[model samples]
Target chain A: MIGFNTVEKLKGIVVVVGNYGSGKTEVSINLAVNRKRAGIDVRIADLDLVNPYFRTREARKPLAKLGIEVVMPAEKYLKADLPILSPVVAGLIRRPSQLTLIDAGGNDVGATVLASLADAFRKTSVQMLQVVNPYRPFTETIEGCLKMRDEIEKTSKMTIIGIIGNANMIDETAIEDIYKGYDFVKALSDESRLPLKFITAPATLLAEIDTGRFSCPVLPIERQLVPPWIKAAGLKK
Target chain B: MGKILMKGNEAIGEAAIRAGCLNYFAYPITPQSEVAEYLSRRMPEVGGVFLQGESEVAVGYMLFGAAGCGARVFTTSSSPGISLMSEAISYISAAELPAVFVNIVRGGPGLGGILPSQADYFQATKGGGHGDYRLLVLAPAGVQEAVDMVMMAFPLAEKYRNPVMILGDGLIGQMMEPVEFSDRFKSEPSNKDDWATNGMATRNRKERNLVKSLFLDAELLEEHNLVLKAKYDRMKQEEVRYEPYNIETDYRALIVSYGTMSRVCKTAIDNMKAEGVEVAMIRPQTLFPFPIKAIRAAAAKDGCQVVISVELSMGQMVEDVDRSVQGKCPVHWHGKAGGEIPTPEEVVDVVKSFIK
Candidate 1:
């Protein structure tokens, strides 16, 4: 059985950062949904000015149904490529909910948006987690993960306190991939001296894999950042 | 290496490298700037050249210069940026240089929204530039196919010594999927010494090669057009590729679609199947050759009553579908143009309209 108590650590001002295509947005959305499902008041700020697509705003309608507030840019500048941060993000940081999650963009360049909000973040006790998908390009190795951590820390001007393992090959993820990912992040946590808060597996695969093997909690991921066609087919993963 | 999750834009960049294309020149555009951003770092690591031109105009010429000297090169841009490159595209086509162009198309006529759209169907399949030249256009429905098509595009471009285009919508540029890079599509660099403008000393030839598209004489221009036309005709006979879905069933409606929109139609067809309404689809992998015979055959199926061109454009590809049907059945158009994609339910509803 997996311990659900470890998820309690994801409260107050929690920020998510990672390399490009490392599944940061997926982890952030699942985190918000996880906390919200647990009956905790969750509000997430979409600080992803770097990427134009697959951001938190795309899930606004569904998130609203779950009563989890999704903060994003204004309607006028919603699709524009410019970096126009909304004041509500600062407002969310100043007065956080039970769990305030900030979904930062991908990479150090994406994380640069966080540096601009340093004043808002400094006022609060923030807990940043770097989601590492070892299957991704940059964070595939321990050295690459360390380099990304340093670059993200330098650009965001915030220190990461924990790691979130999100290794998978999308729809092709297998049982071995989960084990490989867990081992990779476990080693990453040890080398970096950061806590391995949790690792994620597709919700469908949770029944097949033994959750007790993980040293940390296993967050069952229900994928939300998928193309519309996948959603239409009702394929859950 | 095992399959890794990658966005379409980055995968396209890596696919070029795997295809042995060492030169990449591009301008920043929405939905596709990641290609340049990815290649900017990856190119130097691989000891290749990645240049960000002053504009798409300059970038187009950069591709021309690189391809003229027998270098494998490519560029990625959106609709408006592609318009800026059309003139150079014409020159390259007329010059018969081998190069690749990927248009991760967005909504357009002017500066349209940055969301996915197939509105550039006419711009791509037909001549976008002012000339009698045609580009061999390939459209991919998913990220894996996008990578495969990009890898295959270089060889196809070189095979005919002409520019080849991979016509993808914005979703294909932005979406993430697991892609495995394999050696199945790899090809050796073609011998361009016969005609390339590479220095004569490199090939050690006595006669110098001149690369130019200009042919001032009327008869010479006509001859050049016929030669280009012959290559295009060969592509029609040799390069037509498409996937037929649910054709086994006596489908009442045949849907013709391509790129990201076809995936949506697939879902709609599957959904319709559950309700006992059989609808078939013909998804064109190559947009220019267009699988006209396949579409014509699919539309002429025994139970097929109507053919619909379901697209993200405002009835752009519908014209081609109409042309393919050629009065065999009642051809219809269904789509949305304001960057709003038609949902499976919406598609089901649209398909049902033509049913009973």
Candidate 2:
């Protein structure tokens, strides 16, 4: 039945922002595609100004055929040092699709650029979400999250709508790691009141969880942001 | 079974399987590394594809490849690593595909520090990647909500043919809470294999669909944009999600917030009410599909004196508050962005100031 998120008619935009390694870009890609499968019109933009590594425009070839529109700085104007501000993005704000995702760069410095779109934000509805990871150095404590939230908001003149507890350990992670992180984030969520969004998981731990107790939604995490290791290991795909 | 403690990250992974998502991919990142670790061991048991990509960039594209095959794929990463995935995310949006992504967010501004921060709010809600598009943003306040969203995300993605996000910070990802997946999942058919590059079908002659984001010409781009716009227009008429807390209260103010931040506001509202300060909160469950109309009603109600926009960041959702108020009443803001959450007492103080 359409009651399932994959078929339900859910509309609106979702932005994925965080510090450099907070995984904003990865979140942006998956969220954009997933929404489309749910029967919603999804649009996306690559607004990162911090690095020159993998970016959305790089995947233009495949995304184009899917029929979803991608908005980015012109190829001719693309540069590592270019100030990412442009009038083109304003048009997107003016005419957002059922779901529009913005994957911003990391840090207060990166998110500060939202001030550039102050005009667009002033004209329409917007919700900014802060992604938090407990395993990261500075973000290990609740106080750390508060500090970062202040820095980003002050820089952009935008308020964070909520907090997303995305704590995780890479390949070496243990089930206990998730349990530990979940407890910490739950405390922060209780204290802050911002909804803790998705609790991301890899496929390995599905058997260990008795999922009936969680109150929020869950999102399956795919590692599409980073390149494949098999290919790097001299293996062919 | 009532409230078994579990990690948010693990719960998310398990919940997805329970929700019927069989494909998983990701790269290792700080704080969220367990997501990859967990999937590597479990995907095989469930007959799901679980591959740990070399870099965050590669993992993102792999999701693209899998999505191209019409599989319910997903990935996760953190701060600096997520920076590497923007390229593929933009492509995913452009393709209007179905998949799920998770960011166990960490703190940073060019690797400034590893910690929690609401800094990514603008990026998540405002189209973080390059495109004129939006992803349905689901902000779960706790582990339970996180589990519910996973079950919901796949169907939502398939129904809309777009990506969906469960924007969680480190706090949520790391936290422990009890969850029940058996009650969370209800199997449904997936359309991925039909066109998702399922080896070749000898019985049929359907074109081998290619999923791409390329629009080399202006006309084609324009057509795609128009089609997307129409879809969005339809969405406007169909989607609006929220939970009104204490809305039945009269007089005073409307406290607006989402995610776990609103919980702070709720405490403040409750505490302040002890001093006879009346306040209502309008919390949105889906950050992207914000409950705008709800705010308007709260504002136009008989005794509401003010609308307060509360959050982890300075005030990203403040603009929405202004829009809902329509200039009738001033919107107030109370937030702690860099990981600080205003105490109930502080929130009460803020709310009391709005008392008529």
lDDT of 1 by residue, A1-237 (tens): 157665666789999999988988888888788778777899988989889888888887778878888999888887887888899989899999999999999999999999988998887899999999998887889999999999999999999999999989888899999999999999999999999999999988999998878888888787887787877112221
> What's the lDDT for residue B148 in model 2?
87
TM-score of each: 0.97, 0.58
User: What is candidate 2's lDDT per residue for B162-266, written digit by digit as tens?
Assistant: 777777766566555556666544454356644465666632536776677789999999998787667656555666678898888775788887766676677
Who wins the DockQ comparison?
1
Task: For residues A1-237, write the lDDT of model 2, one tens digit per residue.
Answer: 111273232245555666545656655665565566556788888887754444666555555656667787778655333556556677888888877777777668778778888888887778788887777534668897777788888887888776666666544456676666677878888877776765655445746754454555555444454221111111111
TM-score of chain A, model number 2: 0.84
Q: What TM-scores result for chain A when each predicted structure is judged separately against the true chain A?
A: 0.95, 0.84
Q: Once superposed on the true structure, which residue ranges of model 2 sit more than 4 Å away at CA?
A: A1-237, B1-3, B183-189, B193-195, B199-205
